[model samples]
Each structure stands twice: as structure tokens, then as C-alpha cells.
Target: MEITIWDEYYELLPRKELEKIQLNRLKRTLIRAYHNLPYYRHKLEAEGIDIHRFKTMQDLKHLPFTCKEDLRRAYPFGAIAEPLRNIVRIHSSSGSTGSATVVGYTAGDIEIWAELMARTLTGSGASEEDIVQVAFGYGLFTGGLGAHYGAERIGATVVPMSTGNTARQVQILQDFNISVLCCTPSYALYLAEVAQEQKVDWSKTRFRIGIFGAEPWSEEMRADLEQKLPIQAFDIYGLSEIIGPGVGFECQARAGLHVSEDHFIPEIINPDTGEVLPPGETGELVITTITKEGTPVIRYRTGDVSSLIPEPCACGRTLTRIKRIKARTDDMLIIRGVNVYPSQIESALLSFKELEPHYQIVITKENFMDRVDIKVEVAPEFFSDEVKTLEKLKQSIEEKLRAELNIHCHLRLMEPKSIERTSGKSNRVVDLRKKEGLT
Candidate 1:
């Protein structure tokens, strides 16, 4: 397999030299965090740590862990290290849980973000000649602008579709002869379905590469997407707290996502104990921004569960790669004494050829006990009027869910297009337990 290299200087930087650069950046970031941010300053003082004497990467473990709550407590601008005038752009989290956490970027920070994005696009098999259409929503969300800047930086013709208007998105994909598509994984699959319904011929256009992220999807989902869209689908990972969609990207090998070690440091730690686990041990992902100047974070707990692959990738990039996220620590659901993740349910549902990847997990309290019910939509052809056939299908799905989720769950089969679809991130889980007066 042929792989595209974006920046030979940094992407292929020597390990020793890279570490030296990281240490320098880490020291500078800590200095700024200690002197500029009150929250970080207080935390460091309470720990009896001298920010000026902060030494090497090994010292990362000694620093305090920053969580989403820290950012929330700091609110919009307290986390920022640079002056307000230096900030050129800001992107914020959706704050579905609470107050939105804001992330700022200086002029230089934006350039670095664009560079990382360019690397992401090229690493996913895109080129300067390819026409890239970004379907992620723009504005306070980072997905749209992050992808837009990166594609432009790579000299690709960017459509800047910026989510919604599914009909128009299809029209642009066909009319513009777009070779690369960027959006959430669920949106990609949804587009494939809509395009087929509109009789858009794939062979006529140059649509072959898909860059998907902003949600956790299974390998089964990837295979289903590849078969449905006839494209090489690659997973890109990032968050607003980090640098949006360019923090890590998969190469042609598709084994793991290579992190941009020159700018960010990745660590896996036990969610409960906070002990940094060795490579290949699954735990919550923690990150520290080494080069970020606007709003640098130290040991920011991402809450994503995955392991590090210390082994060199076949693509020849020496940067360490992280296994695709299995499930976020916070996304894990406890039901009937068993821990379950939505991706586990998704993997089981997508395994069946007769079912679509569209499903919803509904959690509600029943008689003081937690219950999980999955409502899945079957392929249009698989939906039948026969009661026996439908029941058999439901039984098969329930059995598979039991094997994968390790707990029996109530399963219901629905007709095609019965579940709500979105061009943005798909809301797969509907937890009604809270509304039922259970905390």
C-alpha cells in the first residue's frame, strides 16, 4: 500500500530530537499555565511544585490532572494562556452536559492546526488535486473550520458544505466531482443511503476517499461503510479541548491512529486509580499540549478508552499510534450489574447483513432496576409482514447483543427510515433514567 507523507520534517522527525522539542515546549507551557491561569497556578502551588523547575516528560505524572470539570469551572477564558488580543479564533464544546468549555487559538496556533489538518487529509489518501467536501457543521463547532482550513492548506478544492442540506450535499458530491468527503461516520453512511435513493451514480464521480470522525464507531461500521459507498474510509480522532479533528489520523495501514507527538503528548491512565498504564494497556486517554500557546492543557483527561501501540507502523512514521477508541469512560453504561458501551451494541447490530447500522439504545428505570432496550432498524428488504419472521430476527439480534454486551437486552426491530437521521453526530443513546427521578 502506498502512503502519502504530508510533512517529512515533523511527521518523520527523529525520536530523540522530537522528545527534546517536546520537553522544551512542555516547560514553556507549564510556565505559562502557572503564571497566567489562576486555576493552574493554584493547583501547582497546592501540590508544592515549582513551575519554573518543571523538567522532563517524566514529570508529567507529577502534575495535576485536568478534567472537563476543570474547564467548565474555569469557564470561557480562564484556561487561555495567551492574551485575548492574541486569540484569532475560538471553538467551543457542545456543552450537552453543562456549560460549554471554550478553546482559543492564536494566529500561530491556527497555522499549526491547519498544518495538522493537512497532514490528516494527506495521510488518509487525499491529495492536492482531490476535491474535498466538508459536511461537518461550522461555527462554534470545530469540525467544519478545522477540516476546511486543512483541505485548503493542502491546496485541495474545498466545498465547505458545512453540514445540513443533505440534498445539496449530494448535489455537490456529484456536481463538483468530489474525491474526498469529510464528516461524522454516521453522516457518511446516511449520505450513502440518501445518494443511492437519489440515483447518484458513484462510477460517474471521483468519490473514493472518506475522512470520518467526531464519534466513536466500530470496525463493523467501517466495513459496512466501505461496502456501501465503495470508498476507502479512514477514522480521524480529535476533540475541541485538543485541536479538533487533526490530533490523530489513520494511515493506509489502518492499524492505529498516529499521534502528532511533536505538538501533543498522549498517555493512557487507569480511570479509577490514575496510574499511567504501560503501552498496549487500555485505559482513559490523557493528553498534554506541548505546542499549543492559546489554551494549553496539562494532562487533560479525554475520558476516551484506548491503548497505545508502541510498535512502529508499517507506514514508516515513528510517531506512536493509539488504538481506535473502544469506548469513552463516561459513555460506559451500567445496567443490571454489567458495564455496556454503545459501540458494543453497534458492532453486534452491524454484523448482521440483514440489518442497517442505525440503532438506538434506550435506558430507563424499571422497578428500581436499570433496563436497556435497543430499537434497531432493519434493511428495507429485511422488513417483513410475517410475525414469525420478525420475531425470529428480533430473537437473533437479542442473542447477539447478549453475547457482545454481556447482558440480555430488550430488542425491537423497526422498518427503514423509522429512526431519526442527522447530518451531524447521531444521537444513539437515549437515557430516560434521569427524567424518571433517578439520579
Candidate 2:
């Protein structure tokens, strides 16, 4: 129950103790799941797996990998291990993919999550002496509650400032003298932009650190966030299935995220073959939470693409660090920052009657920027006019995308059949940013 907060805390422990302790946790989790979770028991039986055989981390490779579909197939409550009475809280996933994924937690599960977050805050120099402000949304969304509990556990003064109303958020920053901020990277940047217009003295504010996550952002974007905001920024990573943001966090040294391996075992593997990859090799991340009580999953394929490093970091933590996500493997274009999937775009575009579902997304390079071309094959009636329908369609798409993604995107229209068809997963974005950068 009293796990140390950082990898460095246990790095010096003899190799035998580390393995012995981890095995004990693993065995207990397996024994508990086999008895309480029918899905897990059935899965183990179907796969003919004996947890006793998986005595070491190396044995993880032999277990069947889990995926999001596994959750969908066991929807609502099948995956939950603990009974309804013990589950104290639940949160909905942002779900860019489809219907939101729901994550549940028992009181003990919440306690452990708070412990990791408290450890993370301490690593970043937050303490009872600091005031923590949370700007993420509350209710079903996980980010707000996650930060609130972490801040509370750390004994910091907590300000639960859920999203929307920029002026109010700014007022809290000035009045409360918030020393730490926990919110999405975009929202932090947005707040800074408002402060600039309002002539807010950002430097005078007490904020010393910002923990941003819940959305993918670029290093360039991260730099922008730090420069504009009043504090140094650290990346926080989590998912609904893994008990939210405390799963891994960045320290001031900023090498990579320190994974909470005591609770969730992190691994990287080839997206296609599920072959376990070595540290520093970029691949999809899969996590199996050993500590969750209400709904526990083993070898859950997170669908997030990242790499891992096992070496002790300069920050003196021996915990594993996961690289920034390259992209989500299952849902969409897993490029750098953009998470847009063509199917979701199609659904949006088709909502307008004038636009045809038959459109092509041509991702290309131009002038050191990503040139994305959305070619919507116009209906025969609209094509009859000599006036270029492309321009109007471009405007419509630009407006819709701006409203949806909060970023400006260029649009293009092609006659039907312009997009090259393929038998497998089709290319949605042809990134020319790489070539542009090279030249």
C-alpha cells in the first residue's frame, strides 16, 4: 500500500527484491481476477493460460493481448470485476472513435491512483505549500477529477475550475495565486491567449508548473504553451481504461513520462504482429493494470503509438518512460499531432445534404507544412455550373473543421474518382511536412 512515487526511489533496490515484489503483486492481481471477473476467467480458460506460468515480465509476451473491441464486446459492465456496491466512481472517455468508453473505480483504486499522482506532483516540486488549479471538465470526464484527487492527496489547496468561461479562469489565477495548473495543452494555451488580450500579468501570477494532457500535442505546441503561460509544462498521459492521468507523468528534467509500473505494466510492441519490442523501439503501447479493483484489464492494447526506455534517467528515477505518442494506431491517421480519421470526417461531411460522401482526403507536403486536400465529388446538379464548386466546398469544410478541431485546415475538391482506392487501410493524410522540412 505504501509504494514509492518514482522509479529512482526503487532503482537502488537489489534486482532480486524488485522481481520478488513485482511477482507478489502480479500473483495477487491474477488470483483476485480469476475469482471475481468472469470475463477474465473465461479469457484465461479460452487461451489456456495459467498465471502461474507467467512468473516474470518476459512471460507477458505469451499472454493474449487485449484491445478496445474487447471492451465493446463486453460492454456496459461485463469487464467490471468488483460488484456495483463497491464501485464508487466512474468517468466517460472523450471517444473520438465512437461512443464514449466508461471507466469505473473502487475506493481503494482511487486511493492508489491518488498516490501515484501525489508522487508525480512531488516529483515536479508541488507540495502542501502550493495551490493547485484544475481547468479540465468535471462530471463524466476523467481529467478534472483525476487532478483534483491528486492535488488533494498532495495536501495542496485545490481549485476545481472546470472548462469554459475564460475570464473566470483568469480571475482565479490572479485571486487564488495558483502555483500549479492541470489541464489540456490546448486549453492552457487558450487561457494564455486570453490573458494576453486582457493584459494579465502572467509572470506575476504564482503558477510555477503546468501538467497538460488528454489530447495529443506537438513539441512545438508544448514549447508554445510554456512560453506563453506562467510556468514550465510537463506532459501527462493516461486513458479511461488505465485509471486516467496518473498512469505516467513528466518531471522537470523532461526526458519522458515516468510510468506507474506498480499499478499498470507498460509494454511496447509492433502494431501489426504484437511482437514485443525492446526499449527505445517505437511501437504501440499496451498496459495491464495490476492494481485496479472495480474493472481490471490485462494486456489492454491502448492503441496509442509510443516507445519505451528502461534506463535510469537523470532525474534519478529508474521507472520506465514512454515516448510521446506518434499517433493512435486503430482510430485514425497516427501522424504527429493530428488525430483526424477519414471516416469521422466523412460522417461530418455527409451530414450536410449538398456534400457527397464520395470525397478523397489527399495528404501531401507543401512549403514546410502539411497540405491536406479534401476532394468532395460534387453532385451532378452542382457541377452543371461553370463556377468552381471547389472554392465554396473548401470554405464550407474549413469552417466545419475549424468549429470541430479548433485548428485551421485547407480543403480541396476533386471530381469523383480522384482518390486512389486501395484494398487495405487507405491513406487519409499524405504528409508532405517531412519532405518540406528536409528541404
lDDT of each: 0.91, 0.73
TM-score for each predicted model, relative to the true structure: 0.98, 0.75
lDDT of 1 at 290: 83
Task: Give the lDDT of residue 89 in candidate 2.
Answer: 88
lDDT of 2 by residue, 274-342 (tens): 999988998889998887888787888998888997777676665678887646776465333676755
- Deviating ranges (above 4 Å) for candidate 2: 1-16, 331-371, 374-439
RMSD (Cα, Å) of candidate 2? 11.6
- Looking at model 2, residue 374 earns an lDDT score of 69
lDDT of 1 by residue, 140-215 (tens): 9999999999999999999999988898899989999999999999999889999989998889999999999999
Candidate 2 has what TM-score? 0.75
Which consecutive 10 residues in model 2 have the weakest lDDT in total? 420-429
Residue pairs with clashing backbones, model 2: 7-318, 8-317, 8-318, 363-430, 365-432
